[model samples]
Target: MTIDLPEYPFPQPTALEPPAEWAELRAKCPVAEVRLASGDQALVLTRYQDVRQVLSDPRFSRLLNADDAARVTANESGGVFGSEQAERTPVGEGHQRWRRLVGRYFTAKRMAAMQPRIQAMAEQLLDEMVAGGAPADLVSAYGFPLPVWVICDLLGVPDSDRVKFAYWSDHMLSLTRYRQDEINAAQLEFGEYIWAHIDAKRAEPGDDLISDLIVVADAEDGQLSQMELIGTAQGLLVAGHETTANMIGKMTAMLLADRDRWEQLLAEPALVRSAVEEALRFDANPGFGMPRYLTEEIEVSGTKLPPGTTVISSMAAANRDEEAFDNAGDMDLRRTPNPHLAFGAGPHSCIGQALARTELQTALNVLLNRLPGLRLDGSPEELPRREGLIIGGLERLMVRW
Candidate 1:
């Protein structure tokens, strides 16, 4: 008997939550062909096992055919954060060098040390939110600022330039208003800005990631070029801030929507860490997933995916696979052996996950403590969501104490 494949309404990266259809897809076609908005053929992986394997397995590569790579890396019009050569470069030694140079600074140890500072930043942001009074938009006042501040602090970016950086970062990730030209321009401009900082740090070395990268670039032969270093910095700046910010907003909103869970968390503050993990599992931005492309024809879960086909692994679907988790839809803070792929898997697993977890735990704790009666100011259904973006999050999260 032939099984019916589930259909997803929005584009792969478009935000439309409660991906109920994905359950059917996971069961029916662990791997299936899907059409992209650009009218290209793409493969979709829904099952936890299949998605995890693809991510960890080196057989399926990050680079696609030249045409597909161009399309994939093309900047959105009106974007302030530009595209980089690193993104355009297919698999090569340069890629390895770029990864190694940045990886050193983002080591687990460094991220652990940043936890205390992240917590402090979260607390300071929440303090400001409390001072702002009731019916405040958490997204604007706290959720967004915490990650931005933490990233800026780590990168040694001046606080005065944060507003501009924030704007550039948003446009960089935004798919709606930005075209390739705009994104490329923004990326070049940002690269120049970072290079200037790197140059300054060379003369008067600072104790920061950028300074560290500068040292590596200067000392190592063929490790990283000046532009490459700038590109790395820009990439870190964007990733470090944007993804965490959205996750913070989405996780908080998810908790608020489920009052019992919210109350449970508030009552047992110790559960904050697990609660964050569960939230990460339960309410992942539905449309966003890691993108891969087949370097050669490969069979995935009985499906023959041709070379150059774009494959999207739905992390949201993988996390909620019923086969993997009992009552996968439910938020259980006490969940043990929960192996959610929220940080993804393999060599490309999120580098800042440790710091991100700390930020979430700290933010949630401070918010619940400072505002015991914290409740949604408006209906969740009424809240507007940003569209045409890979990351899923609310435009604003208005709340009251």
Candidate 2:
């Protein structure tokens, strides 16, 4: 029996809460087949436990679904569906080694050490926002700039070059605005830019992530090539910039959606961490987490799936699953064991999670502490939403103190 699932990222009235359809799906049809705008059919796992299992299972491979694998082809020669060549995956010791080489850079200790710098950057952004006066678009002015600066700081990219990186990063992550042609061009430009910059950095290394990468590349040779460097830079720029930055805007919007919640956080400053956690859970960034492909036959909640089946897991919906927590729909500041998949799960989970947490907490804390009178200038629903299916965030956040 075929069950119709709503398109991924069902049109949200606002960025704060996910589409209400997700709730219905969770209750009645936890695992259902969804027809995507790309004219492809895929299974969507909505329940928290089911989503978690799919994410944590190693058999569910991401490389397989790197392309739109659900599109069925009429030609029998091409099999039932049309999927692009799977991206290469590092195996065994190579994968572990690669993880360690890059993973150490984003450890809790490293992020803690960078706290002062992150706080200072947040302070500087707030200072500029305050100087600009009231009724400012906090998103473009503060939300976007903070993470851009933070990531570039780590990469050793100069402030003057941030706009260029931002443009490229925006296109790379954009789901709706830029077309495939524009995305390809932006990607090409970004690669050329990063490659040139890496050469410059190679000539004169510095005390930064890019320089560190250069040093390792020099020693390892084949392990870190010029192309690899370019790809890494792109990943760092795109991934590092979009999600956490959007989280800041979305989280703030959620926190202040209720004036009482805003005031409560203000009254008890200690709740800042709690408030951040709740915001992360409440405004979990991706409506549906990254896509995965099933490498082996699997049964999720009794829905049997054959191998090579594409699956889309909704972390946002999973976070709101009734069985997951008490008052799952509401944001509880002190909700213990808030096991939201905002950062995802397993080996493919976010590598920059520690840094992201630091940036979110620091940015939110600065906002509440300094701008105690800060409030939404208009209804969040009326505020512009991002034009993308992969990620959802406010296009602009107008605020006044």
Candidate 3:
């Protein structure tokens, strides 16, 4: 049975709800062609197993040719984040070296040690929320700032410079309000800012990620060049902050909207981890899974995808595949052995998964403990979802206790 996939202006999915049409597409054709915003044909992998295999399989390369990459973005120019150049970086040796250099700071052990600090930051933010009274915008009061603060502290970025960093990061990740000139300018500004920070670290080395990167660079016989260092730092700054912040806001809003779930979490705090996993599964905006171009003709899930075809693995769709989970649409905090790809799989899997989990777990625990009667201040339907672009989240979430 052929199904007509919805066109652009499609309703953005939320942490609390999947797009209404997802189930239909999953049932009919798990692997189908999607017309991207750029009006180019890109393969969309909707099934859990198919998406996972595509994400992990090296046959499908993330490196896109200049022409294909440009076509992927509606702007006809390059993307806001310099994704074109990012993908061009050699995925074998160069990528591994880069990942190794930064891995020291993002290790699971180090993130585990950061739980107390993250919890402290969460409490401080929640305290201010209570002081601000009901009808407070959680995004501004807590969501936006918590992850930025934590990541900045971890990377040794000065608190005062966070505002500037935040601006550049937003433009870099934003799909709307971006032009070629703006994207280029932001890249240059961010590069300069990171270089300056690296210089300062060189003068007085501190116990931070930047300082550690410098040490590794010097020891590796200068394997990491100046541009690479700055680029790596900038990438961490954005990923460490934006994605986690969105998850925090969306998760909080979802819990508050469902009083039973909120009470369930409060009564049994041990469910926080499972709750976070469910939140990741339900939050449908990670800017679309990492895009890959077929290097050679390959068949995925019985569909013939020719060489040069762009493939997009939808984490939102995969998480909700009925074949993967029973009653996939329902939010079950008790879901054991949950195998969701909220974090992409394989070599490109999120390097900071541990840190992100720590942040989410900490935020939920503190919010539930402090705001037992927490509830949404406005109707859930009224909160507009950020659409057309990637990274699904609410524009603003107001809450009252």
Candidate 4:
């Protein structure tokens, strides 16, 4: 059952709408070929089970720098996907060890403890947004800054340098947005800044993720090499800030896009937790799905994939599979026992998920409590999405209260 390979990330009619091809592909060709921005071809998995299987399987690796692996973007550097830092990132046992060491800080309990601080930050940002007046772009005013502030605090990064951090992060994760030279320059500058920051932390440690990791590294006597340490910081800074920031805006937009959803939340505040999870599950534009380079032959959805093949798991598509969820297309605020692959799956699942969840829940709570009248200032369908980035998100969430 072979079909023409459509461009990967099939086009969407609107910012909030899912691509029509997601359903078609999932039903007809669960395992199908697609072309990447780099003009390389790869197979995309659209079924729920197959997507999760490939992600959790150890045979499918994140080592996308293999000579034969398909480049993810048009840029020669491969953006973050094929970057030197990504190549150096530990895999297998070494990767698990790195996760164990850093996972301690992101546990549910720790995120729960950090909730108050996150709430305070959200409130302050909301206050400033309110003071500035309505018809505001929530993406810039509220969504962007909140997560950056949280990540800065977590990494002990100076808040004053957030502008620079944002710039570096953009180039690092960009798919078609930045040129190769610009990406290289940004990486160099970021590396130098992180190294200097590490030196400063070594001289004077603080109660932050990086400082704590440094102490452990020092105690373990180079258990984590300097490169690993720097990569850890850079990875956390980018992942922590970008995904959650986009999500905050998207979640709010999803709720307000339907006034009924907002009214339901206002009526039943207990649904906030489940609502956040649902928003994650319901997000249609979550950017490029996870890419894994196969080290061994594998068959997915009856399609045989050979070694040295690059396969993309379209979690967004899987989330909407009717075979996976009841009435999968509808956004049910009360959808309980919801499990979605928004953070990915298996060993490589997002380490900062707890923190992200906390921030989102807190943001929603604060928005509901303070701006009970919050409503979309424009049509959700007309909203613009951020272009030329690996991650997908709204460009601006126009709202007024």
Candidate 5:
């Protein structure tokens, strides 16, 4: 029996937990049907194995997904990075090329090597937040600033531009929240910003990722076109800060939900890493799933899907799956073999995950040590959440020491 799924951009649940509907679907029908905001149909994969299978399978192509007419609209080109289609490079080999090119610069070794720098930045931000006294909005005081600084410094973006970038990121990533005209306006300004930044790097390169890409572009047989270079920069700039910043605010909010979680982390700094991982798994704020277009007929758990079908693999639901996890609803800091899809998996997995982890771990350690009395200013229900957007996160996180 097929289910007529509820609208996508499913209303923000009052709590941080994944939707109750997801669990019901996972048990009764893992690969249930869904109706997107555009009135287009899709499959929402809720089960852990099924979600992973969809993400891992090459038959489910992102490029093909973008090529669909049903998804393309005035507001979106059905972009994976939440930007215009032409603004990005191709997937498949293009994705591999991106991974290879970026792997050299964003390696785990490179991120590990930058730990001291990341930690120092965290301390500097926290110091200012401490100076501001208590009852500060963590989102602005620490969360937003930390990643914006780190990513801008990395990409060699000017100090003047981070604010503008944040504004653009907010408008652009809000897929359903903003109108088509509003998104288009943002896209235009964002594209202009990236192109200008690229040109600046071309004129005088620096010891940064954009500069490095410029060098690669100047090399013979280099595959990176100017558009691709600009697109890549935009991707790093927007995603680089937006995702990590929200994660920081959300991570802190999650910990503050329970004083025991805070005490446990304060007692053992080593546990901070696992705490970050658990937070990643526990947070289901990125309410909308990444869209993948099917290239061939496929099926999972006795349900068959035809070619050209759209599927929204539910990482939120899968991560909380009872079959894959014990006490699935609980946040367990000590869970071993926890294959959470927080960073996603397969060819299209998040490329800057290492840096994200470093940022998160550093943020957690700094917050706990520096603010002994840090706790939520209000209960979860009293706090507001982002609505009508692809991302799930708090509107503001007020905390005090």
Candidate 6:
């Protein structure tokens, strides 16, 4: 049956605005059909409760490599969706074990301890940006490098190799950008690089996550396989670098889009934490949301979804659902008890969330303290949206102080 479904990433008037379809879908068609970049159809959950349920439930699995699952992209290998690394990721009990191994390093206490270093990195980036003078592209000047440096330090990755990491990440995140061959080559290159790095780490372990994982894996009896080790390193590098990098850019753009928001934070420094949460919840362009494949027949929002169904949970959409938050459209910097799903939900929620939060809070504080005069160099509507990636971000966030 040929279904005339609207495209998955609905058209937006600007980079920082949500698609009109999100509000409409939540209102009338909470569970709506949409076509992906691969031209395959999947059901998207826009309502807060439905999205939360799908993500938190065990039945909606990340096993998108199934033969019957809808491919997320048109690439022959489905980009990151059906990549070997994704396939190698542990599931069920194995997944729980994997999370346990990685989660220990990302606890709130550890992230808090690392805040000073994160703040220093942010300060250095901001100093460099200021040295370059005004009308700078914040995305390039401050946003991208901060998270890259932090993640690289965490993984024992050399700072000199950041350019390559960026390239490999972009290729792996292809939605409609690179050709199949290009994507394949990038993955191969990234895998080879990670393997080589792992070999180096094995010989001389360092005080980093990769080295720590190597030690743990060596001690464990069949707990983390060699492939799992490689997948873990690769996954951390990409997830730790890409999403956070894009978010720093998006978060800054959101604040500067409204001077009052920026002023609000500067006036009440205590609001930094809550403001970051609000920004996460209020983000209109968070790129391709988390995708889950159904393992069995299930009902969501009174709709029955059968086995083999591929459902995309629009966390960004759900974050803005009126039913979930008071004045869902308003950006409340003081919003308390804010339980936004920006890091996702359930067992599969982002493990590095604490680290992400630390980086974000540190970055915002450093910026507000150092450059209270900061303002956008261009209008919000004039900003260009980054294209061809599952994650959404601004191509360039021009700013001045």
Which stretches of model 4 miss by more than 4 angstroms? Answer: 1-4, 66-88
Backbone clash total, candidate 4: 0
lDDT of each: 0.68, 0.71, 0.71, 0.81, 0.74, 0.80
Q: Quick one: ranking by TM-score, best first?
A: 6, 4, 5, 2, 3, 1
Give per-model TM-scores.
Answer: 0.87, 0.90, 0.90, 0.94, 0.92, 0.94
Global Cα lDDT for candidate 4: 0.81
TM-score of 2: 0.90
Identify the runs in model 1 with alpha carbons over 4 angstroms from their true place: 1-16, 64-101, 284-286
Q: Per-residue error at 238 for model 3, in Å?
A: 0.5
Model 2 bad stretches (over 4 Å): 1-5, 64-93
**lDDT value, residue 385 of candidate 1:** 78
Candidate 2 vs candidate 6, lDDT winner: 6
lDDT of 6 by residue, 287-399 (tens): 77767889898899999999999888888889998889999999999999898888777777777778888888888999899999988887899899988877677889888
Q: Which stretches of candidate 5 lie above 4 Å from their native place?
A: 1-4, 63-88
Residue 45 alpha-carbon offset, candidate 2, angstroms? 1.0
Tens digits of per-residue lDDT for model 2, 25-54: 999998777876655777888899998898
Which regions in candidate 3 have their CA more than 4 angstroms from the true location?
A: 1-9, 13-15, 65-90
Q: How large is the C-alpha RMSD of every model relative to the true structure? A: 4.7, 5.9, 4.3, 3.7, 3.6, 3.5
TM-score of 4: 0.94
- State model 6's lDDT: 0.80
Best by TM-score: 6
